[model samples]
Structures are given as structure tokens and as C-alpha cells.
Target: MSIELKHLRYADAAIQHGSFRKAADALGLKQSNLSRGIRTLEERLGYRLFERSNGGVQPTLAGRDFLQSARRILSDLQTIVGAANAVARGTAGRLRLGFYTSLSAGNLRNTLCDYARRFPDVHISALEDARSRLFADLRSGALDIAIVTGEPGAEFGTSMALWSERILIALPDSHSLAAKDALTWADLKRERFVLSLRDPGPEIEAILIAKLVTPGESLDVDHHDVSAESLKSLVSAGRGITVVCESCMGSVPSGMVFREARDGNGSTRVGFCAYWMPANENAALRNFVQMLEERCPPLQP
Candidate 1:
């Protein structure tokens, strides 16, 4: 016969207190009722769990073994309950995080590190991919949340403005502009611009046109569907100069140099946001999203 949790709890309390009356008083049950419960439990196991005397109740040899197991079982059950509570409170569980390229070095990295420290029990699985794949995984429920560039899309149930990085010009070492102390948009006017043919590529081009392009003047940009690393390789070969976020400077090739652009209003920056579906039922994801909201609130207009 299977032993019930109530039986185990009753036995443990009686053994710990060493008296049925005391255990019953502690558990707020009648002494007679506690004694009868123990009897029923012992009968089911076909053993005498306790020896009674004028001194008090003491465990029989067989009762010692049974009571030890009962205590251990109760302890394990308590631990399980505690863990479930932690999950419900958003302090423990698994978080699936998806991010686009170049997030590991900047604010996203710092934010994740802080989150892991704050909620040590949360198991975060981070994946990096292109914006298209990131958004797709977020939509399909393969990912709980995603850190992507540009504004949040219509598919996102909730979104937060994470951070932004100023745009820098990536120039080849041999390029004439590399010798200059600083670069400006006008400096790039005559230069060929290389851009990634990804989600932010068009966005970056638009920003360039808005900030740097003069009225009725044409800007030449070469779009390559490649990674930032690949883009650096192309830049090192002197294919064309490209604009990138400051966070990406460390990843540039040896022969390439990143120079700050002279935009007084600081409009030459790439914005990033975190997106998640409102229907996601994961407690860990909710916790992470709440933490992100606290850390990076939306920028006021």
C-alpha cells in the first residue's frame, strides 16, 4: 500500500516530539486522533512503529527506518513546493532569449549579466541570429523574448526601448580619411558606403540620407547580405567604408579603424528594443521583461 503524505507528516511530528500528546498539541489535533492515525499507518505497513512506556514513546527498530524515510520524503516534498513557489514568483525557471547580431558587447550584455546575478536560479539560454530569424522565433514561440534593432513591430505584444549607440565610421587604414582626427558626414559625401543587407541596413541607409545627405544630392551605398565580421573583411579590402554602432568597434578587423562621426545633435545613433509576445506564459520570461522595463524605460518624446 502506498503511504500518504499526511501519514508521513504525522509520523515525523510524533517522532520529532517523542510523544503523541505533544505532537498532537503541536499539530493542533486531538491526542486520541493522532494516536489512531499512527496506528492505522503502522497497520498498513505491517509494523509497530513506536514502543510506548510510562517514560514516553520511542521508535521501534523497524520504526526507526520507516521514520527516517518518512522525514526524508517530507523534506523533499517541502523542497519541491518551495521551488514551485519560486517559479510562480518569477525568481526561478528557464528563460529563452533571442538576439540579433552585435548585442553581446553593449547594453544588452550588461543587462543580462545584471539579471543573471539578480535572479541566480533563472536559467537563461541565449541565441544570436539575424533579425529575420530572431523575429520569426519570437513569433513562433520558439523564443520567449528577443532583443532586436529598430522600432518594435506589430507582431510584438509588448516592447521596451533598450538602448542606442552612436554611429561610427569604419575606414580602411590606407584610406585618406583615416589620417584625420575626426570624421563628419560631409567627409563621407564623396566616399562609397558599404552596408549590410539586413533588417537594419535599410534603416541605417535612411538615417544616413536624413542626417548626411543634402537636398537633391545622391548617396552611393553598396548593400551586402553578410555579417558584421564579413562586412569588416570587405572594408579591410577597401571595398567601401561603412557606418556602425560604437559597440561594434572592438570586432572590426586589424586594418580597419573606427572614428566617431561629428553629429552635434547625436541623431546618428542606432536604437535597439526588446520584444516579446503578450501571450507568453513563462514566468521567467515575465520576470526578465519586467526587469528590462525597470532598467530601460521607453524614451520620452
Candidate 2:
């Protein structure tokens, strides 16, 4: 006696229409077939589900209980199907974007706005953290995609250098270096420097240390958001100078000046790269990567 969905469906229709003839019409089935299905269902359950009357039909206690469960099962099944369809269409899913401090301004913000406008149903979220944390989040599936500063030897499922811009030196407007169009690394040899401490990759720090007399005199600020603000304040107060990506100049506080670093190979550029898990195949993530490449072409390695 295998239970079937058609049996439950027939039972529900029969109860709704109050007679087998009417239920058959509603279901587009012959009256005899409908009556047989109801009879088989009642027999399998060892109970009389309905009381036949000349005027109408009424459900017995068992039929009433069965109808409740049948409706719930049907509703749940419909929901599952709808969710599957939504995912297939690239809508109604969550996307976690990993972004580093430097990109919060120009490229990252523009890309996010475009993605949101095009896919309004997708749930988009951002995790603003350092490079190392962003990579960790991607590896753990906490993030679907990350925009990080380039790391040469790090393991990644897929990565591309999105863009690069020269590093700039921020100084007080009254500082001696402010008179120059650009200041070389040598110009800041004796100047105090402020930098973000978290994951400033050894390669970049080593470059700065090689040019400065006392690289340890550099201040370790928490994150870029804080570091940038604090650096501007320190510069305004004539406490120190800092080196930052040119993009940071847009938000620099008043009384501070920004100039390209002299030793900066016009290409002493910071790289923006994207990373994702190779094995975790997701349509939304793939589409996002494509969008990034389309919006901002990658720089040649």
C-alpha cells in the first residue's frame, strides 16, 4: 500500500467540491476515476474519509487531518521549486564581497553600484578588512570574491590584477617638500612617516625602509580609514608625513598636500586583484568576476 501524492490531491479536491462528480470536473478527470481514487485511498488508510449524502459530501475526522498535512506538503514543495528557479536565473542569492582599505573610494564603489543596479534581487554585502583577512574570508567561503592588493606567492583559485596607480606622499601644506611638484623617496629620508600596520606586505615596507634612515620611526595605525584620517591630522599638525595611494588624495583633509613619490616609477603602482575558490562553482561569483573585468580591465603582470 504505497502512498501517492495523486491520492492526497484527489482527496482534497473531493472535499472542496463536496461531490465526486464536481471534483472530477474541477480536476478534469472522469467522475468514475475520481470516485475510484477516493475509494482506494480510504481503503488503504482503513477508514471512511467521507460521508456520501444525496445533497452533498462531508469529510470524516481522518479526512480533515489528512487534508491539513496534504496542503502543507504541497506548499513546501512549491517553495523549494521557486528557490531553485531563482538561483538558476542568477537572482535572489547572497554575495559577499571582500574589499581592502585602498579601494573603498573609486573603483570598488563604482563596481558595486553597477552590480547592484543590474541585479537588484541579489543580496550584496561587503567585508572591509586588510588584505590577509580578505584572503582568509575567501578561502573559508565567508566571501565569494575579494579585491586585494597583489601578493605574489599566495595561493588562490583565480586572480587578476585589476588596476594599478602610483603611490603619493602626503605632507603638510607648509612642509618644505610641499613646494616641489613631487618628492623623491630620498627627500623623506629624515621625515616621520605614518602607515597602516596590518598586512602592509613586507615587499612594500622593505622598499620604504631601504630609502629611509629610521624606518622603525613609522607609526602603526589600525586600518586605512583610521590611518588616512590620523595621517592627515598628523600632517596638519606638522607631526609627520605619509605615503599613500594617489586615490586617497581625493579625501585628504584640508591643510595637507599630496605629491607623486619621486622614486615612484611612474608605476610604483598598487595593484588591485580578485580571488575566489576554484572548486566552489557559483554562477553568481563567475558573473561578478566577468563584470569586474568588463568594468575595469586588468593590468598586465
Candidate 3:
């Protein structure tokens, strides 16, 4: 005969009340049924559990040990059930996230904070890397989602437009352009630019070419093997101006300032998108994607 959860539960209740009648009333069972369950449990273990007394019932020395073990078993089973329920509800699990943008400040940073607060049980593993690698990781199942600059195209996976941030020009405090309230793309044409030799650096170079590149003239831009922040540091030292997204404005190095880069329409803004595998079935990923959709809905045509 196998000992079941109900049998252990019955034994524990009887021990707690020290009476079959009281335990049966507490468990909403008939006294005779409670007594028989206890008797069957004792038979399974080949030992007497409770001794009938004038007080109603009391545990034998062997019954005391069985009750103690039964209580522990019940506690562990409760923990297991709770954890499984949390996973089933998508509230508890691991989320592997990939992003290339700086979270110094902006929508990306705010979204992360909101997600953490809303789903405390989700263990978020945030990985910062280049765009190509983020896509590679997503395809390999190493990442659940990736947020990056520009439309991630159809080949990466499913993509959604999430948010957009202004493209700002970083200039030295003493630069003449600092005196202006804002700057136009034409204003940046004659200026020397210092850019990173990284993922966004290439993107920035492309923008500079499209916006400020004059026919039959080369752009005076220096490519530095450094991070975006380091590129800003170069601008702070008056080496040359650089461009960064508005989100990066939070941590601009001292002596440097940011100006909104504008075109004929308005501020030059970079759009960001989220990418994930079409076949990814991670519940945690689904929850995060849903949160993004609610916070940053698709723009109207």
C-alpha cells in the first residue's frame, strides 16, 4: 500500500487536535472515515500510530515521528505547487533580453524599469551588444528578445516598431553652435565630426553621408575605435563634435552639450524596433512583448 497526501494530511490534523473527532470536524470529514484513514496509514507502515484514550486520541511514539515528517512533506509540496502555478501564469521565469542602445535614460530604460516592477519574479538577463550579434543570439535561442535601432528587416525574425528618440549633436561648451537654440543639418555640414567605430557609428556615418555630404566634397569625420560615451568625451575635449541619440543625453561628459539635430521637417529622430524569433514559445518573452505593445503601440499611417 502507498501512503498518499490525504493520508498524511489526515495524520497531521489528528496530531494537531489530539482527537479524531476534532480533526475530522476540522477537515470536514466523518470521524469514522478519519479513523479508518489513520488505521490504513498505520497498516501501510506496519505500526500503531494513535492510541485511544479517555481524552479521545493521542499519538504513539511512532506516530509523533510520522506526524513531524508529514508536516514537512506538506510544506514542500505547497512550495512546489506555488512555483509551478507562477510559471504557468507567466509571472515567474527567466527572460534573456538583448539590446544595443544605452539605457542611461529614455523609453528603453523606462520600459525595463516598468517590466521589472510589474513582474518581479521574472529574472531579467540584459545583454548589451552590437546589432548583428543580437540577431544571431535571438535566432540561436540564446536570447528571448532584442531591441535595436532601425527596422530589423524580415530576415532577423518578427519585428515591431516600438519607440523613437531624437538624434542630437554633441558639441563643446565653447563651440559657436552652442549659442544657437537648435541646429539644422546644414549647420553640421561644415563641422568636423568624431564618431565611434562600432555598430551605431556605422549607422551615424550613413546618416551623415545622406544628410551633410556635399557633392564632390568629402565629409570631415574621424572614426574612433571607442564607445559612444568615449566619443562624447572626445567632443568634450574639443577634438570634434559627435552625434548621439537623445536617450544618451543623461550621461554626457562634462564640458559637452547636446543640440537637437533638425532637418526641413523637424528634429532628426531614430526609430527603434523589437525583434524576436517567430517560433520562440517562452512564456516570459510573450509577457514582455505584450507589455511593449501596450506601452508603445504601432504608429498611425
Candidate 4:
């Protein structure tokens, strides 16, 4: 049918104003154009929309039903348009983020809080998984972004250098090591260590072996299958000492204390980076990346 949205608008305006002349004035259109549009709309529906009146226009019983449907359609169209505009501006829609870091307190946590504050309408879906699974999700388009530790080797595609966090040792309150405000790798040489086989655990183990392992000396370390949360509880119960990132300090267990892990270089740390596909065109992802770049810019060479 040749009937268009303008015809529907014209009909609705005329009904609200109760006069073709007033509707045209309100719509900023010529009265003749408004009248013609209403006529076209009525003709399309094969019905008389208005009963002629000397004072003002009024909808016929049938026209009242038609106008009711027309007003609902107009309202729905307005909502659709508003949502579309918000999505285009990156102020709405969904953003799926993958990570393997503690959100207790860190740059990642701060960034998430700020982004949520700025774009409250945008839904943030976060997933914490092993590094390999995170990489796989990013590759399969299941995740828009993945924040990982160590380096910028986010295999699927583009990567950006983010902030690095200082490593810390989680010691029980009664442990003699807890007396030290900061500790060096050498201080942990004789202590028993407990680590999970999960993400940061494996990554932390690698650092431990690199720093402490030597030809003639052996360090005592045990591995378990548990989550970061459970690992902290185990340490609090004096199961064994464990290493953690600075973010873990935010919500340390009641019986545990976090001490800076250092070496000859001062504070031992692991760098973090963000990885995402360059081809993905999610507006929310784009906005998130912009915010990340602004807050944790890469070191300039």
C-alpha cells in the first residue's frame, strides 16, 4: 500500500487536535498536506475516520478504534528509535567481558565500576575462566574482550597493554613472615607454598620457579585444584602460604595478611593486557576499549 508513516502521524495529530487546521499547525506542515495525508490514511483502511462537524472534528466509532491502534504503533516506534539511538552512541546494549583476575580491588575493578556508572544502561556480562578458555571464547566470538596477565599475547587478534599488578605473599597472622612489611623472593625460599592449578596459580608458579629454582637447591611447593577464593581460605587456616596479586589484598581473609613480594628489582609484578578481535563491531566493546586505553595506556616506546 502507498500509505506511509506520515499518513499515520497525520491521522493521530488530527485526532488529538480535533481539527485538520490545528494538526497542521502543530506538525509544521501545510493544512492541505495534513488533510491530504489523513484522507490517504482513511482511504487505505477503507473507512470514514471523522464525522463532519461545524465546530471541530471527532472520530467516528470505527475511527476511534483505528486511532487507538495508530497511537500505540506511534508510541512503539518512538521507543524503538530511542533504543537504536542509544545503541549507536554506545550508551546501551550488552558487553561480554572475560577475565581471570580478582575484582576485589584493582584497575579492572575500578574500570568496571566507572564504566557501569557512565553507561548504566549497558549490560556488562563478565566471565572468569582459565586463560586457555578465555582465549578460546575470544576467538569464537563468545567474548568481546579478555583481560589476562603476563603479556599481550591475546592470540585471537588485537591486544593492548594494560596495568601490571605487584605480586604479594598471603601469610597467616601467626606466620613469622607476616612480621615483614615487604618480602623478597629469598625470604620465601624455606617456606612451604600452596598453589592452585588454575590460571593465576599456574602463572604465579612459573614466576616462583623462575626466581627460586637453582641447580643445587629445591623449594617446597604443593599444587591443588581449587578456586582463588578457596585458596585464600586454605591459607587463612594455616594450610600453607600462598602468593597473590595486589588486587587480592582488597578482601584478604580475616587470618591472612598480604605482604609485597619483591626481588632484586624491587617489587615483583606481572603485567596485564586486554585482547579482542579487530573485526568485531560491538559499540559497547568499542567504548570499553576506549576507556581502557585512556585509563591504562600502553608504555610509550
Candidate 5:
């Protein structure tokens, strides 16, 4: 039978009060209407739900079993409604996050840990990839947010400057320049610069060329399409020296040493930005971004 939810609720109320008159009073329903509703329900189920007498009404033996099911169904429906409301309010749901390679230990890690602690109900799944892939997934709606180095395109989504990293020179431990207290861009002349052919690679190359290599000077640079681990391996084997951020120094291979790059000024800097679709409706993303803004300092240009 196509029994409605209101019928189930009326059945539960009647059973709880054990009297049609009392249930109707509590529910703001008239006694006759409540009694008629219960009678209709019992008829649909082909069973008597209550034993009526001058002592008022009580569940028939079969009615008790049916009432138990009714109570559970009503409670479960309420729970379902509550969960839907939470999702609509952006307080719960899955968050698909993407980040650039070698980002697991720095700002991204701190932001993720803090987000998990504050919003335990929000499920977060992350992917690490190059910038091209990250932005591709972001545009296709497969990714909700992306943490990438350099500026994100306007077509990709709304971008917020998140954090910056200081450029450091990575040198072989046995290299002559490694013995120096500090090194400058001018010292890098004739040095083979090894970089990964990845998203941030081009960005980093531009920065290094601008800051270290003088105009009209040719730089010996190598770009490899490989993972971060493989990149470090190449540097450790004396393939060439490369530049990296202070944040990435922790993950540098054992044979590689990091040196401050003094460009006659201070540290040369690279920036990272958070990208999200302006139309994204995920509530978890809202909470995550809010938490990030609260916990992280604003990006200085």
C-alpha cells in the first residue's frame, strides 16, 4: 500500500499516548480526524492496530510490531533530512583538493591538518600533480581547489595569493661552490641548471633568469619531465645544480646541499596561489577557505 509519511507519524503519536483523544490534542489534530487516519492506515495494512474500549485505546498484539517499524522509519527520515540540510549549508561534503609536487610538508600540509581538525565531517581527498594537470582538472570540475605555484589563469577560476617561498640554490655537496658561506647569481655562470619540466619549472626558470642571470647572458639550463624524487636524484648524481624554494630544501636528496642565493639584495621569492571555481557550491570548500584565511597570514602581494 502507498502509505504516506504523515500516516506513519500519526500512528507513532497514537501509540505513544495510547489514546486517540490525547494524541489528537498533542498534535493539534481533532480526535475524529486522528482516529480516522489511524483507521485508514490499519485498513491499508489489512490489520487492526488498536484495541478500543472505555479504558481508552492500546495497541493490538500486531500493532506493537508495526509501531516499532513506524518509529524507526520516522527517526531515520529525520536523520536523512538533517544530513541533507548540513550539506546544503556547506558544513559537510567531500572536498577534492589538488596541489603541486613537493607541497606535502609546508603551507599545504599545515592548512590540510588544520582543516581536518576543525571540520572532521568534511571528507578531503588530495592529488599532487604539475600545474597544467592541476588546472585542467580544476577547469573540468573534477577538482574543487588547486594549490599551485605562480598565477592561475582567469579562465581557471578565482585566484587568491596564498603563500610565497624563498629561492635557494641546490648544489652537489662536493662542488666548489658548496664550500662558500653564501653564493650569488653571478657565481652561477657556466653552471648547468637542472629543473623539472613541470608547471612551476617554467615559473622558477623565469624568476632565476630575471634575478640571477644578467641580460644577454646565456644560461646552461636543463629541463626534465620527471617526478620531484627523480629531479633530486639527477642533482645528487652531479647532473647539474638547480634552484628551489626554502620549503623544498627539506625534501632535497642527501647528497645535495642548499645555499642561500644572494642576488646583491635579499632572497629571491616565488609565490603560490589558491584557485577555486567562482561557481563552486561545495560547503566544505567554504569552510576550508575560511579556516585558511583565519590561520594563514595574508599574502604580501
Candidate 6:
């Protein structure tokens, strides 16, 4: 037999009040209507739910067991309704954010914290990856939105550039260059450098080769989630100095100091850009993109 929520609610109310008249009054239904509804429910279930008594009514054994189940069903229904409303209002849902290694500790961290404070119901998950992997994920639907460094000739569905900062030289506190207020690319011509293998894309490698002297030997680190943190540790131990985005200075090891590269103007600047599939735009994702644009204006592409 088909059971409806209305039937369950009426049964729960009747059992709670323990009388047809009281149940009807509470439910804003006439006593006769309430009586007939209960009678129909019992008939459909093929059992007598209540036993008529001299005082009024009492639940039968079957009725007693069914009352708890009925109440539980009604409670569950109410919870489902509440959750549905919350989702419909865009006040609750999950957001997956993809970010490159560099931004994870700087602007992205701050932006996510602010978003969480304002919308506590929204669940946010951050995934850190290299720029190439992040771009692939964004195109394949693996990421909702991603923060990546912009490429000059690459095509994207939709994107907004967030921040642009000149690359700075990270040197150990004891390094000779640390005493200098600022550095030029030529200043590091003879220094051993700790470089991430992933830092040199076709475009960036050309720039780096043009500026710094080829090191006799170097540490080739895998560029991943913990790569930057590990690189900072190496610099702190006085292993070598590396060039990184100026924003990364805030997160580098305590003993490390960052200096602006004097020739940084024409150098590759790190930028944060958000990209998503153009055809898959939803209200929440759209709002998030709009928020990024408002917070950080895009550079001319």
C-alpha cells in the first residue's frame, strides 16, 4: 500500500494527543474529518491502530510500534525540507577551489578565510597543484575554479586576473646578497641557485637563461604542494637562493629575506587568474568569479 507523509503526520499527531477531538483541534481539522482520516490510514495498513476505551482511545500494540516510526519519518521529512531550502538559496553547498602552489599561502588563503567567515554553510576544499595540472583540471571539469599564472598566448573559456607581483630574490639571512637592499638579475650571476624544475616553462626558461649565469650544479626539486615550503627550508640552510613571487616572501622561512630584482620589470610577474568552463556557469560559480573580479582587477590580456 502507498503511504504518504500526510498519513504519517496525522498518525503521529493522533497518537500524541491521544484523542480524536484533541488531534483535530491541534491540526485545525474537524473532529469527524480527523476520525475518518485515521480510519482510512488504518484500513490502508490493514491493522487497527487504536483500541476504543471507556475514557477515550488507547494505542494497540501495532499502533505503539508505528507511532515511533511515523514520528521519525515526519522529522526526517522536515530536515530534508530545511536542507533543500538552504541549497536553493545558495547558502549551503560545496565549493572546490584549485590553486597553484604559490597562491595557496598568500591571497588565496586570505580570500578563502574571508569567504568562510561570511558563508559558514558553504564547504570549501582547496587543492594545490602546478599551473599546467591546474589548467588541465579546469578544462576537464575536475576543478570548479582555479587560480593560475596567466600565459601570454593560451586560450581559456573565462578568466579573471587577480594579482600581479614582481618576482623577488629569496636569500638566506647569512647570504652576502642579504645585506643588499635590492638585487639585480646580474647580481646573482655567480650564486648557486635552488630551482624548481617546473619553474621553467618554455617562456620562463628563456627569460631565466637570459638573466642568470648557468650554475655548475643545482638542486632540481619537484614542483608540488610542499615544494615551495621545502625550497624555503633549503634557502634557510644557506644552500642557495631562488627567485619567487614577491607574495611568497610572507611565507618563506624566518631566516630568509626577499629583495626586489632590479630588472624585474621586464621579468615574468606572477599573476593569479580564475578560470572556469564557459558553458557550465551556475549562479554560485558566477558569483564567485564576480567576487574575484571585484577583489582583484584583471591585467590587460
TM-score winner: 4
What does candidate 5 score on TM? 0.85
Count of clashing pairs, candidate 1: 0
Ranked candidates, highest TM-score first: 4, 3, 1, 5, 6, 2
- The lDDT, on a scale of 0 to 1, for candidate 5 is 0.81
For 1-301, candidate 1 gives per-residue lDDT tens digits of: 9776787777889999999989999999998988898998999999999999877799999999989988888899999999999999879988999875564367787888888999999999998777779878888998999887786657657877787887888889999999997877778878898898875667778878886788788778898988676788899999999877766765768799988887666447777888888899999988888888888776678
Where model 1 places Cα greater than 4 Å from the true spot, the runs are: 25-30, 209-219, 250-252, 299-301
TM-score of each model, in listed order: 0.86, 0.67, 0.90, 0.93, 0.85, 0.74
Stronger candidate by lDDT (2 vs 3): 3
| Stretches > 4 Å off in candidate 3 | 19-36, 53-56
Give stretches of model 6 more than 4 Å off.
16-37, 50-61, 84-90, 151-154, 189-192, 199-226, 262-269, 279-287, 297-301
lDDT of 5 by residue, 1-301 (tens): 7887887888899888888888999899999988888888988999998999877888989999989988999999999999998887766778999976475366777788878887777789888887778878888889999888775457557887777777788888989999997887778877898987776778778877786677778667988987666777888899998877666755767788889887766777777778998898888888877776786567567
- Say what the RMSD of model 1 is: 2.7
For all candidates in order, the CA lDDT equals 0.83, 0.73, 0.89, 0.89, 0.81, 0.71
* Shift in Å, residue 156, candidate 6: 3.6
The Cα error of candidate 6 at residue 1, in Å, is 1.3
Model 6 RMSD, rounded to 1 decimal? 5.0
Residue range with the least summed lDDT across 10 consecutive positions in model 4: 147-156
* Residues 149-241 of candidate 4: C-alpha lDDT, one tens digit per residue: 978862569998899899988889999989999998888888888998999888898898888889887768888888777788899999899
Alpha carbon RMSD to native, model 3: 2.3
The parts of candidate 4 lying over 4 Å away from their true place are: 1-3, 52-56
